[model samples]
Target: MKKIFFLYLLTLFSLNSYTQNLIWFIENDKFGYAHKTTGRTVITPQFTFAGYFSEGTAVAAVGNHLLSSKYGFINEKGKWLIIPQFNAAGNFSEAKARVQQNGKWGYVNKKGIFIIQPQFALCYDFKEGLAQASVKNNLWGLIDSTGKFIVQPEFYSITDVFAGITCIQKNITDKWEILDIKKKTSIKTNFTRMHAFADSLAPARDTSNKWGFVNTHGNWVIQPIFTNASSFSEGLAAVEKEYGSWGFINKNGEWVIPAQFDRPGYFFKGLALLEKGSDIVYVDKEGSLVFSFKR
Candidate 1:
């Protein structure tokens, strides 16, 4: 089946070491290239700036003029896979790429053919089977890979589809609500700020500015309590309850680890990166330090 477009860069549930295969920079009046992970030089720095590779291809700005930029796709071996033609472009997703020309946005196939017309004011890369597009009113809605409107441009804001539900904000006064595309109705909500329910739970904020967890049915499983909170990852979430410190919490609102770090990022690959003073540390969900790394 053809994949749908995405509203934004969707985070995968499973964590892995995502790497940029190549890097590009301008050096000595030319663009230079190197293997980002290995630090090995591949192409001489000659282009003005280089974008990361996606689907084994990348785009580069060749001249000094920012508006003169054209896009080209390159292979892993630094060969030109598709010559630059697009006035502006984004990485490929779901076998299609978002491109800009004549100050409008559309999609192009791997072969660089325009598959969708440039009509929407903004567009996100495809994911699952839909992409988010913005209408003139600046409201966002979902479209399929063929640019067909599947969800009309009515939502003031939206989150990527998680599990099978997407969080959408209908109006500035309205709180974030869940939308079951299958049901075509807003899922009930009591909290103002909430992440899309995944794994049967989501993070929500009370009017008092405290944070907690809730199930898909809009029931609070973890009462509204923390000062700050993040979306769940690996059954854990980074939260802050006191000034200048952060910690992790489980679905039941249990403090799996004491609030201690200065700042904590969401967990990935069995570890979460944290800060203390000027130092950075990796920690497990239990709050034990895994290792320290240079920031």
Candidate 2:
């Protein structure tokens, strides 16, 4: 039994490693994928639109125009795993993808079968076995994988579930509050605004409009100082120190990459995209330019 468990763990690691090595790239007006390390094109640009791989599949679209494109799933080799049919699609999460049929959104299995029928006016990708769905434009709630409402539609807005916690706004004028979804209880917080949690921390704004990081328990992990801040990703987050200047900071709130770029993005797979002057570039954790691309 121990040997069987070891093999299962190894298999999962291998699959994760393979998916992390690929990044979507754009060529001409088409989208393709390339190796993250070597920047070698693994799949030629063909799709009108493409998204990062998740759960061993990536979302791609094909059609003459963006407005009329039909989205589908593709494998590592760029072959269509699920034929382009849906008017829109999202990345696979928890073995299911949100797809739009007719005009309503629903969740479908990897086999392109609707496990959850298209009824939602809008929906988000599943996170932590739960997803935010809405029957109306402004009303949102949480639903389990079985399409049953664990939390009925009431919040004006709901952030993505992370670490079993989510941030929700009760009304348009209501401040965001942390909720422990599993426990169905609200966590008392001093924050005036909060974004979705990532890497165990959420980018939050205090009553003074200063940004910082907060833990799942609603305690400030990093004190509010920055003018603007983004959620942590792979241990680093992009923060705006002053107007128009952004840099990367560690969890300790230290500027790992000094405030210089006009704009900065969160680190993903050891790299982050930044903009300086009129140039858009991908840089390593050390702030070394990996490559520049046309935006």
Candidate 3:
């Protein structure tokens, strides 16, 4: 169930927020950080792979994603705080980062001490004081920073915890159910896909394979209609119409940026990445192409 590993590994490096004015990016197959506002290089691209800094530290690897063995923690200054030894590493969250040792996963503190022993079949970075872990590759559950099970291992898989609410699915069941971290409510649902919550709403796919947004209470704020959709960021969500054209939509379901781009990304810090034919362009919330990357 190192699904958490797969989920993170498959993502292409993008401009992800690190600190208030810093961001992470990849150039020439190497990962580094840069100033978000001025677009100036702060940390040069050196690591084979890099993740956004959390609590001032990031996870970096030195080789291919699958066969790589050199993984460690790096500080904002691009210095190794923890030497590369683990098989895999998760970005620091809540001052702890999940790491793999001898094929089992555990969490280490800022000092690289194993606060939790390497025992879980899979482990994820803590979010909202809890993390998803699996035991023996079967019992999925929620564990606190102390490595105690807050939610017993019984579900098939656990989704990201957001706003004290996380949706889970039962063993072998296709339907999803909600788990209220605060209320300890029983999970239940019919969503074909339950995306991570963003901007006070989460994207859910109906049985008909259409996408829409639902509030924390599970009420549909926007009807399921888009051919393809993404979670919101900065009050805007990227969606596609019938002909594969992409645009940005406000929470009210109104098109803020009319469908025009061939493909689009979420707005991060007032700008989104758009695809114009084979090239990449950065566009503002107003849908104007501000910067185009030369190939």
Candidate 4:
């Protein structure tokens, strides 16, 4: 019995390490997972929809159509860890995954049990131990993992908290302001639009409709020069110089990758998704093609 238990523990540890290197890939209109380093298909493309692995599990669907399919959680071996039941599901974060049931959003544990019962009209995954949830009327607020409101449900919308900072809009007519989560105070700024804070910076739009990067103090760290921008990730951000051309830029606002792709996504685990014409490809930090999945 002792030898059997030791083998089980060793298997669990190996699976956990393997999951950290998995990335989702699409083939023939179906989704699967692959080893990020070797581009080896770990799980064949069988699910109608699949999400990136988080905390050793991924959300996947197996129905003929996405709208009619049920979502569930799968392990690194492509086995069902949580049976398909949720109307929709999100990747696990902080040991909980957001799931939808009967049109209401809530959180569930790795065992598929509700940690936070379904209540919010809409919700997002937890980041830094806090999540954005909304009650009736679409009023948003920040809630802890236990479903308790850290910031009361009054804002029209609240961005995800990062590095102790977030952006909130009180109403449709109100301008966006930076909220210091630790200090519980708003920093004055005139942000027409803003995204969640990431990598110590947030993408904010100026009055002239140009996007730039801002520090937590609501001050511009990189002036508004790009026609569009995304939040920083892995020390770089995606920006657009022209309407149809996107590229990557360092925090210093210098181009790291030339503006050539039709669309670009933020870097994750040293790879970022880009579209050149009709092909979808992943590129490394230096703009070298890592993998391509033709749609």
Candidate with maximal lDDT: 4
Q: For each candidate, give its TM-score against the true structure.
A: 0.67, 0.88, 0.81, 0.90
lDDT of 1 by residue, 180-284 (tens): 787887766756777645556777888887888877667788887788777777888878875558888887788888888776566654666566764555566
- Model 1 gets an lDDT of 0.67
Report lDDT (CA) for all predictions. 0.67, 0.81, 0.76, 0.83
- Candidate 4 per-residue lDDT, tens place, 209-255, comes to 89999988888999999889887888999899967698999989899
lDDT of 2 by residue, 1-295 (tens): 4334323322222112126778765577677888877889999999977776888998899999766999999999999899999998888888999999999999999999999999999988887899999998579999999899888899898888887889988887777889988788997666777878988999998889999998988888999999988778788888998666989899999989888887656676777666676565668898888776554
Native-referenced Cα lDDT, model 2? 0.81
lDDT of 3 by residue, 111-229 (tens): 88999999899977787899889987487888998999898888887766788888787765577776788798854667777766778888787889888888877778999998778
Q: Residue 188 CA error for candidate 4 (Å)? A: 1.9
Clashes of each: 17, 0, 1, 0
Instruction: Candidate 4: list runs displaced more than 4 Å.
Output: 1-20
TM-score of 3: 0.81
Clashing pairs in 2: none
State in Å the error of residue 214, model 3. Answer: 1.5
Residue 217's lDDT in candidate 3 = 76
Model 1, which residues run further than 4 Å from truth?
1-52, 65-68, 195-202, 220-295
